[model samples]
Target: MKAYPITTRYIKRGEDFIPIIIDAIRNSGIKLEDGDFIVLSEKMVSTAEGNFVDESKFEPGILAYFCYYWSKYLWGYALGKLLNIKEEKIKNLRKLPKKETLRHKETVIRTVGLRYALKPYAEGGLDLTNVPGTYVSPLPKDPKKWAERLYNEVKKEFGVDVVVMVADTDATYRIFKWYITALPYAINGIISGIGVLGFLLGRLAEIFKVGGFAGCTPLAIAGNKVYKNYSIDQFVRIAFICDRVHNTIKNINEVLEKYNSYVITEEILEKLKHTPVVVVKIKEEYIPNR
Candidate 1:
């Protein structure tokens, strides 16, 4: 159950993740055991795959309208309420320049769409929270394949079986109700009637005094469980902190420091300074046994 942070070597635009993972494991001195697991943040994989999209590339169209109104009003509002997004920012969301506004708005839609259409298991907070610019990215296409590849690679290099898990920082909840409507892909993985159900259930969980982080902690655990045995060449989506799904992974630093007391060493910082990847150990509870 040891959670190891593998900071990748600053991966190039098209660099594959296999080698970066290998380097991280090697540098961290994490000798894998038969039951050991590797938890990978999907953002790292998305960056490796160049899954990002420039908001500037979007053209004014129906899709833009959907983002501007539907996402901003629905998903954004709900999350803003939960995360306490600044009122000023929420207000400003409505007055964005046509194109930038559309891109940001559409980013929400596309995020929601991916959640619903592609991975029903993904959660909300998939929108742009942390990145260098105005761009959004979705979960990788073949997590199972990527997981398999990483598993094989780690096994070959280290002579120990390691489960590969692709994770995001989004929070998730259980389905509280059923729906018969279609959601936009922009909001695909980020919002849905399913999420609405989860949201409601989250509220109920609170009222009932259930122990949870608004149902997100359990959902992240489920993502890890579901992908425990995915294809060797595929990436297995795994445990994530619901709060990490924001505009960037930068904020993760603070969360990591809060939950994990391991100091960021000078060597680690130096490596991270030059590489998109980093390597460190998180507390064991965050790691999955499978």
Candidate 2:
């Protein structure tokens, strides 16, 4: 199988994504054919649909305060150490500020419920990586619809019958064949919304082999018979690889420096190759092996 990262100019709110996808395909010089799998970064779709929140406006409630304190003091120092989490991450969690942390926790609680709000960064698929300022992108409300729309548009534009997968960059834990993720839903056999307790349990039990970030909540897979049995490992590998390609700015610090407004302007984004779309060409002969 081969993966092609399609580079395009920055996608702004209210901009039609279909045309941008067509342009990216044209620029990549890759011919679309039947059964080709198209993977899209969920952030791009969310941004286009204006599915973002101004985190600064959130007001912390009692539950949010408790959750913040528990996560920072208890989870960060005790549970985190028990789970063997990275020392740096543990330290960062312990050092999280009071007011800001409470606001962030509150946002998570309101967005994905109290259970999902307990997880680490990118809680409930709310991400702050690419977007500027205090603007955080949430998982698309209806990913399956977007996937179907993209598939239809691609067929209309290029006469190609391809599969579309919308994915995020949040981590998912797996035990043997069982895929456990923080998101509430998944397309394959992935168990979702297991929360922080599940994450810790999975780690302590040593059942998790690949603990890296998986795709987002509501991963939408449309069209193509080849993806019927696509495993969790395959999805995680592809999603993580594609996510790295979508990170136009090498790191968060660079993103902040380049776009002080926090919102990446079309002008600045145009100069960089923002690859939000990836085309994964699966080899039919190796389907059984995969």
Candidate 3:
């Protein structure tokens, strides 16, 4: 299994990710073959898909306020404490409303239990540095769409049997878990629930060290044995190895935790300023055959 880092200027809106990736791999002197899996940064895909929200246009509805005051205090504080966040921030976060709170507990439990949790890895949530006023960039609504487009592009350009996985580099802070949330060639609607389940399961695999395979529960069940020979399978393995990567959550307390140095390259930051797709590719064998 091999992982290659392909860095370049930001990918603008409508930029075809397939060409960028192929060119990058070629430039790196790595030849790709059929069955290879590409692990892309999700922000890049979101950006290309116009999945970002300008903070200047942010509208914190009643829900946002509720999150800010209620959930922040209760669930945010509790979770922060559970995750070992600092005392002061917990206090501050506790003042926030539940709906206004960006982090939700029941949502976490339902979505992926404790497996798919996130702390702000970057400083853009309520930033004055990058944007003029306070603003937060919410998660993308359709990660799978971004993935499918890239997958089709790859197939058409290289004519290889490949899979495209969009991920977040921030996901790797506590663990190297890249967000895998789309499938390109399945029954469209039937694939939806499966995609969500697989994505959450992938997070579970990372937090709990369950498996390195990249798909869902079925993958966990079926690919259990053969996950080591392929890159996607290796994803399941890493996720499995990092088992139970749970963070804390509570709705009864107020807490605020700050991690200031979450690093995004200035290059990538500028790109994200306008769009979110960050592309990178890895070989089928990056994870060894178990």
Top of the candidates by lDDT: 2
Model 2, residue 90: distance off in Å is 2.8
Give candidate 2's TM-score: 0.82
Compared with the true structure, model 3 gives a TM-score of 0.47
Local lDDT at 173 for model 2: 64
Task: Report the number of backbone clashes for model 1.
Answer: 57
- Candidate 1 structure, TM-score to reference: 0.57
Total residue pair clashes for candidate 3:
77
Q: Could you give candidate 3's per-residue lDDT for residues 104-140 as a string of tens digits?
A: 3223322322222232112111111222112222233
lDDT of 2 by residue, 48-150 (tens): 7888887789989998988888888887879778777778778767866676677778888888788877875557777665665666777887778888898
lDDT (Cα) of model 3: 0.38
RMSD of 2: 4.3
Q: Flag the better candidate by lDDT, 2 or 3.
A: 2
Candidate 2, lDDT over the whole model: 0.73
